[model samples]
Target: MTRYHPFLVFLHWLLALMIIGGLIMGGNVLAETPNDDPFKLVALRMHMAMGILILALMVIRLVVRLVTTKPPHADIGNARVNKLGTAAHWLFYVVVIAMCASGLAIANMAGLPAIVFGGSGAPLPSDFSAFPPRMAHGALATVLTLLILGHVGAGLWHQFVTKDGLFGRMWFGKRS
Candidate 1:
């Protein structure tokens, strides 16, 4: 129910783009394509790499969140809404970190080099197997999807029904 801090807003959008890209790549066309195909491999690899970046960014966001005091939910509709919103935010954080941790472990085991956004060479240990990467990739993808649905659903409820400032905290105002 509290307004998100400025840094949280920045991190949310930053992570949002990464998450959206992965979601789009998860489309049926992309999922059904052969892994051996160069284009398919590249696309999959790109998605995996983006997942790695998200892992890193989420870590940073968690650290920031831990140290900062969140803004008040004084203007929020009521106690029930505020509690749900708060729980949803923490769920988001927990799921994201879980996904990231799994992804990084997979990357380490899969021998796919770590990928940095707009940068080169994150060189993961070469001995890591592809299995861990594949497993983590699947697990994290599932978690991210569920959390996303919950997030969107809550946003819609706030925007359409309560006329609360919940969405605006992340989209426009600080937790208003």
Candidate 2:
């Protein structure tokens, strides 16, 4: 089995960590932070910044994927499963980019005070439901979360049941 390029593996894990951490932090801020708390604004801004970073890194990942060669994927003999895997991979890219775009839209539509990096707070437009993008942002977030779970489940299936070692392709370590 051909191993993934080291740089691609690095970006994969880095983005994964950021996305996971950002989601946890964002959820905490949303559920626990008081509206009057100054930290809430900072947390929200940082979440937005992380989304932007994810977007930038995702674009670079796609570009790198195109320019570099990937190891040939072995078919698991189930045509449906193969197709689903391919679809899921593409959907991962689409959902991530959509999430970032929708997040920006939500921020732009919000009418709350937001603090950007290295800048003071500014009042944003606050009615999220009044803006279509804000609604989409919420919906997309749910979709992204579900897709991530499905992706992980599938990887586990390949690793344990199928015993194909497919998960190791994206995992860190020396290439065999």
Candidate 3:
């Protein structure tokens, strides 16, 4: 098949938009809002919900990818670069899952479920920096951002430079 299964394509684009939105909301909106702000709770609830959804969808995507037939890997005439592409594709799964895990750890550690979701009157912690997973979550966010940029750059290269139609492989089209 030259193209991905329709469901996979759907998940690809859906997850792409969601991951980007989650990153922006977490990094900008949530970051700028002080923990004491009442709106901070609202933002946290949204961000947390999005993160969880992303995680669940990723699991479904992984399963679909494993059981479905896909187009052969693209070749750019460089073995090293080709291997790098393969590794990066797999890394997306790893990094995203890790990011979700760290986010969940932070939530549990900080009692976010009670404060943000349970409507508990307890105040949010003065700072989340005290949670060890907070550090990992921040680091994973940076890594996820970089990986996304690289993935986009590689896709553009395939489409505009190599002219190999690699971009279409992950897009919607007839399987063969």
Candidate 4:
């Protein structure tokens, strides 16, 4: 039996909070942006920055998971909990990476400068000019919706049915 990687657990929940918050906020920003307003451009640029940060943190998380010895799990925790978790996590990464790429794509379609969260800027790859970022962003958002539903369902299962400690690790930083 392996012990829960406490630090990894912390980063996981923290990133989840940030990603969900950013997504919800970005959606509102996009909806509220006026069709003819220049301010919409600025808001999109900032959304790009937020996407970049999410990408970087996700990469860091992947690296950490690669090097760490993940704790063991008991089968009875939930009937299909492990499978759902694995799928949800990988899909979560896919949607996040796609969101970042799509944000850059949309910016390129407008011929705008790259919005780098870490520094002054980076140029958008010329390939991003092919189409609007909306397609990819929309696809990612759709998947994100499903994943969020799956995640919540799993949590409720743990809370009400299985009565397990799985959710506790991510929610409160340790097993109850």
Identify the candidate with maximal TM-score: 3
Residue range 1-176, candidate 1, lDDT tens digits: 46667887899898988877766775454566664444554664676677778878888898987886676653465788778767877887777777667666665554445342323444333322346555665666777788788888877877898786556667545354
Q: What is the lDDT of residue 27 in candidate 3?
A: 95
**By summed lDDT, which 10 consecutive residues of candidate 1 come out lowest?**
121-130
Write one digit per residue (lDDT tens) for candidate 3, span 1-176. Answer: 89888899999999999999999999999988999898998899999999999999999999999999988888888999989999999999999999999999999999889888898989999989999999999999999999999999999988998898888888886778
Q: What does each candidate score in C-alpha RMSD?
A: 5.2, 2.5, 0.7, 4.7
> Against the unseen true structure, what C-alpha lDDT does each candidate score?
0.67, 0.76, 0.94, 0.68
What's the ranking of the predictions by TM-score, best on top? Answer: 3, 2, 4, 1
Q: Per-residue alpha-carbon lDDT of model 4 for 46-161, expressed as tens digits?
A: 66667777888888888887787665544555568667677677787778878878877676665556333333444434333246677677668767877888888877877789
lDDT over C-alpha atoms for residue 134 of model 3: 95
Tell me which of candidates 1 and 4 scores higher on TM-score. Answer: 4
Measured against the true structure, the TM-scores of the candidates, in listed sequence, are 0.70, 0.86, 0.98, 0.75
The all-Cα superposition gives candidate 1 an RMSD in Å to the true structure of 5.2
Which portions of model 2 show Cα errors greater than 4 Å? 31-34, 111-115, 118-121, 124-127, 172-176
Native-structure RMSD, model 2: 2.5
